[model samples]
Target: MKNQNFVRNLVGTAILAALVLALQLLLGSLKLGPFNITLTLVPIILGAVLYGPLSAAFLGGLFGFLVCISVISGNDAGGFMLFSQKPVITLALCMIKSTAAGYLSGLVARSLSKKNATLSLFLAAGIAPVVNTGIFILGLLLFFQDTLVLWANGQDKVIDFLLFSILGINFTTEFLVNLVLVPVLARILRNLRFVKQELAV
Candidate 1:
C-alpha cells in the first residue's frame, strides 16, 4: 500500500509538472506589454498543497527550466532577458523565485489545512504571485540598482521606481491575474476524482 501510494503521488506530480509547462507555453504565446500573465504557478501551488514541499520544489524547478528555455531560445520574444545581458543570472533568478514560491505555498497550505482546508488552498494559490514579484524586484534592485539609479538620474527617483514597479505595477498585475484565475482552476481541479483521492489526504 505504501509503494502504491508513492507511485500514485509520483504520477500526480508528473501530471502537475506537465500542466505547468503547458500553461507556460500557452501564456508565452500571449503578449501584455513585456509581461505575459501565466497560471503556471497554479499547478505548483496545488502540487505543494497536496504532496509536500519537496515535490513542489521539484515542479517549480521544472517550471523555471521551461521559462529559461523559452527565454534563451527567444521563443517568448526574448522578454526573459530583461536587459540583463546575462542569461545565467536570469536563469538563477527564475529558479530561486519559483522554488521559493512553491515551497512557501506548500508550507502555508500544510500549516493551515487542519484548520481550514479551503482557506489554506486559497492562500496557497494567492501567495505565489506576491512571492514571485517580490523576489524579482529584490533581484533587480540587487543586480541592477546602479543602472536603474543612473537611468532615473537620482537615487530618490530610483528608490521610487523600484517601490512602484515592484509593489505597485508588477505585484498588482500578477495579483489580479492570479486572483481571477486561480480560484476557478483550483475549484475545477479539486472536483477531479484523482485529485481528491491523491491530494485530500
Candidate 2:
C-alpha cells in the first residue's frame, strides 16, 4: 500500500511537472509586457493541493528555471534586460519568487485544511499567484529599480507604470486562472477514490 501510494504520487508529480514545462514552453512568448502570462500556475496550485509543498516547490522551481532560460535566450525582453544588468540577482529573484509561491501555497492549504477543506483549497490557489507576483514586484523594487525607471521612460510614477503597464494583465490572468481552475480541478481530483484514500491516510 505504501509503495502504491508512492508510485501514484510519483506519477502524479511527473504529470504536473510535464504540464508546467509544456505550458511554459508553449505560452512562454505571450507576454503582456515583461512578464509571461503564466498559464502554469494552475498546475503548480494543483500540485500543492494534492501532492504537498515539496512537489509544488519542485514545479515552481522548474518554472523558474524555464524563465531563466527564456531570459538568457532573450525571449523575455524585460527579464533578459534584468539578467543582462544583474545576472546573479535576476537568477536568484526568478528562482526565489516562484519557489516561495509554490511552497507557501501548499503549506497554507495543508495547515488550514483541518477546519475547512474547500476554503483551504481556494486560499491555496489564490495565494500562489499572489505570492509569485508580490515577490516579483518586491524584487523589482529592491534589485531592479533602475531598470524599471528605464522602462518607465521618465514616467512620473514608475510604480504606476509597473502596476498598470507591465503587470496589470499578467497578474490578472494568473490570478483568475488559479481562482477559477484550481478549485474545480482540485475538487474533482479529491473526489477520486484513490485520492480520497490517500488523503484519509
Candidate 3:
C-alpha cells in the first residue's frame, strides 16, 4: 500500500511538472492586457494542494528554469534586460521567487488544512501570486532599482510606478484567476478523495 501510494505520488508530481514546463514554455507569453499573465502558477498551486511542499517546489523550480530559458533566449525582453545588467542576480531572482512561492503556499495549505480545509485551499491559492510578485518586487528594488527607475521615465515615485503602473494589472489578473479557480480545485480535490477511498477499499 505504501509503495502504491509512493508510485501514485511520483506519477502525479511528474504530470504536474510537465504541465508546469508546458505552460511556461508554450503559454508563458499569454497575455490578457498590457502585461504577460503567468498561467503556470495555477498548476503550482494545484500541486501544493494535491501533493505537498516538496512537489510544489519542484514544479515551481521547473517553472523558474523555463523562465530563465526565455530570458536567455531573449524572448522575455524585461528579463533579458535585467539579465544583461546582472546575470546571476536575475537568474537567482527568477528561481527564488517561484520556488519560494510554491513552497510557502504548500506549507501554508498543509498547516492550515487542520483548521478549515476550504479556507486553507483558497488562501494557499491566493498566497502563491502574492509571494511570487512580492519577492519579484523586492528583488527589483534591491538589485534592479536602476532599471525600474529608467522604466519609470523620470517619474518622481518609483514605488508607485512599480506597483501601480507596472504590476497592478498583472497582479490583479493572477490573483483573480487563482480565486476564481477555487471551485474547480475544490471539486478536483473531492473527486481525488473519492478515487483514493475507492482504491483503498
Best lDDT among the predictions, by candidate number: 2
Check candidate 2 and list the clashing pairs.
none
Off by over 4 Å in 2: 191-194, 197-201
Worst 10 residues of 1 by lDDT: 28-37
lDDT for model 3, please.
Answer: 0.79
Please write out the lDDT profile of model 3 over residues 105-178, one tens digit for every residue: 88987787767667777888999999998998899888987888887776587867777755777787888888
What's the distance in Å from true for residue 200, model 3?
A: 18
Minimal lDDT window, size 10, model 2: 192-201
- Model 2 per-residue lDDT at 12: 86
Ranking by TM-score: 2, 3, 1
Error of 3 at 103 (Å): 0.3
lDDT of 1 by residue, 1-201 (tens): 989778877988999988887888775334543445556877888787777777888888888788778777776553444534666777888789888888888888888877887777778877877787778778777776665575456887977765665456656766676656656666676677545533343
Local distance difference test, each candidate: 0.72, 0.82, 0.79
Residue 132 displacement in candidate 3 (angstroms): 0.5
Question: Taking the tens digit of each residue's C-alpha lDDT, what string does model 2 give over 47-102?
Answer: 88777899899999999999889889998888889999899999899899899999
